[model samples]
Target: MNRRLFTAAGLALFATASLAAPALADSLDQIKASKTIRIAVDLGSPPFGMNDASMQPTGSDVESAKLLAADLGYKLDLVQVTSPNRVPFLLTGKTDLVMASFSISEERKKVIDFSEPYGVIQIIIAAPKSVTIKDLNDIVGKRVATTRGSTNDKEVTTQAPQADMVRYDDDATLITALISGQVNILASSPQTMAAINARRPQDPLEVKVVVKTNPYAIGIRKGDDALRAVVDEWVKTNLRNGKLNAIYTKYNGVGLPAEMLK
Candidate 1:
């Protein structure tokens, strides 16, 4: 009655327990043999998995992916995808793993397995100086911009029902609205916020983080423990050797929390 044996026998009853462990390793080994690791990502979310000005992948998550691929003796192949498509890419075998600042969700876990967290996420609010909004309540009856289908959009809508939630199609549009003073506030992922803010040195529009923190991780398909275990252990060694912290501090505030490292 081994779980692996049950899954191999095609019994769907214990699908979760049986299939999860073996799928991960099979994917990783296939990549190793091919000498190429296909990683799904968001090239638009700066400082996390975005492409640099050179169009090469550069950011906390991307850099971590490079190391992870190298550790597995494979070259990393980056595939640009939106927030909406990351999970699908992995589950379809079109992507070996997703490192696009993919957030861990309970519902997602039912469909996709996730490695231990490799990064952190925080919701930040940006507004023109004219608005003296210090918190979520200050934006009542005002327009706020966030990427459509983003968790931040849901958070803002839940918190300020009186506020008009303007859901933009992408993070770029949300940033444009905030900078042009088209919206009272821009609520977006902190990773994108930091990269955009870093470029606007003289701009008066300021960003303030105003929400709970969350962790990020690579998303593997639900039955893939082999690849998941490799990614999880790779992150640990990088953080222990200070390479991981160096990458995050290069862009974001600092490395993952000490507890997260553990």
Candidate 2:
């Protein structure tokens, strides 16, 4: 080789070796060493995640995160955040994992790796007590409300092109719109519907499952094997121990599937 080629080759090897060096501890190891496992918790989504009068987080997602941390031998650190911010929290190292009841999607999977599903539920259409709608066909040209930026909005738009969709910033806003007759139907994940049912049993709204959504996954920054593997293992263990089923029963008021029960 020429002299210029030889020098370039030497520089390339030096940079490659330096770049391949590993960190002091991988994400999982660091969490274990620190005895702290930070999880993204959703304070808005009910049944799966929410806060009580004390403003402390509790629900299926919170319980799942606690068990995951216990399996990893660390104390769970609940980092409360909104739906839109959950993935960002993981990417920015603000949280170790997202157990915030976020749904899995093909687009999201490309950016962040998700664990095997801890749970899955379809989005349902909730009609007001007076609406005579039996299905999507009945809602033609009617105003529908969905949580803004949720998969429910995307799914409903695809299924009901003629229906008008009004977007709300959160679950509360969506429910308010439906109950107030501002919108004829509220579309959302079953978790949200379950939460609403639990909160208002007397004047219960009817839920018709329209779309069976993919499972909810705990998100980790992509290519973070150390953390992903640990979380995956934790999910398996939780499923086997009936921890997840217990969580679902306790907070969601519904029993989980045998498959998720592991």
Candidate 3:
């Protein structure tokens, strides 16, 4: 090939490669400069995130995000999001972090980074006592409902592949479905079952099987090393000082696991 032609081709290839490469996220620097950090929290997910009687945002995850912002001396901008859109909001730069009961998983790790676990959530198959669920096989033909794109949904979908999966966009809707008998079984957290029972005491759901105990962490975008480190340190500090536990216990009605506090 002619030298001019070869040079032109190489330059074109380099430009394409550069354009395709993802820009590194500088959330930490941006947050510091702006003195504000936008965090995504799911208000539809009760106990973790929800609205109070006064229509104010109140929940474990909400308090956690607020505390983090307070500690960092930054203004808190709580971005409301649903389960399926949490990661998308973070990835798209709509939010600086996600404190939305986000569980750490191998699949999610491929797309985003996480801070050290601040709390844990149990994924469970809950049904009314009349429904027999002696083992995984018992779930084969049942209608199982869960919040779409959540860790609970992923675990149940993978474990009980034969079951008819009914996915809802958020926990509030999932809880309503269970209460209204739209589905006989659900893959969700114990907190969700509590929320269901709160509304319908006549027919309370019972835990049939515990799917998995998942550790939840704050979600940070990939390549945001500075933000991750800061968030991790904040988590460790809060976990040690009892602030995180207090916030979690206040809303969750249970203390954080002893091991997580350590």
Local distance difference test scores for all models: 0.71, 0.71, 0.83
| Model 2 ranges off by over 4 Å | 1-24, 128-135, 141-143, 164-170, 180-184, 191-203, 257-259
* Candidate 1 stretches greater than 4 Å from native: 1-25, 127-135, 141-149, 164-170, 182-184, 195-200, 203-209, 252-258
**Which window of 10 residues has the lowest lDDT sum in candidate 2?**
1-10
Q: Which residues of candidate 3, in runs, are more than 4 Å off? A: 1-25, 125-187, 199-209
lDDT of 1: 0.71
lDDT winner, 1 or 3: 3
Cα misplacement distance, residue 14 of candidate 3 (Å): 28
Report how far off residue 33 is in candidate 2 (Å).
2.7
What's the distance in Å from true for residue 13, model 3?
30
Residue-level lDDT for 232 in candidate 3? 95
lDDT of 3 by residue, 91-183 (tens): 667899999988787766766789999998988888888888977789997788989988788878888889888999998899889888888
Which digits, one per residue and each the tens of the lDDT, describe model 1 over residues 187-253? 7765555545565555645565566677788887755677778888887887778787787777685
Cα misplacement distance, residue 160 of candidate 1 (Å): 2.4
Clashing pairs in model 3, backbone N/Cα/C closer than 3 A: none
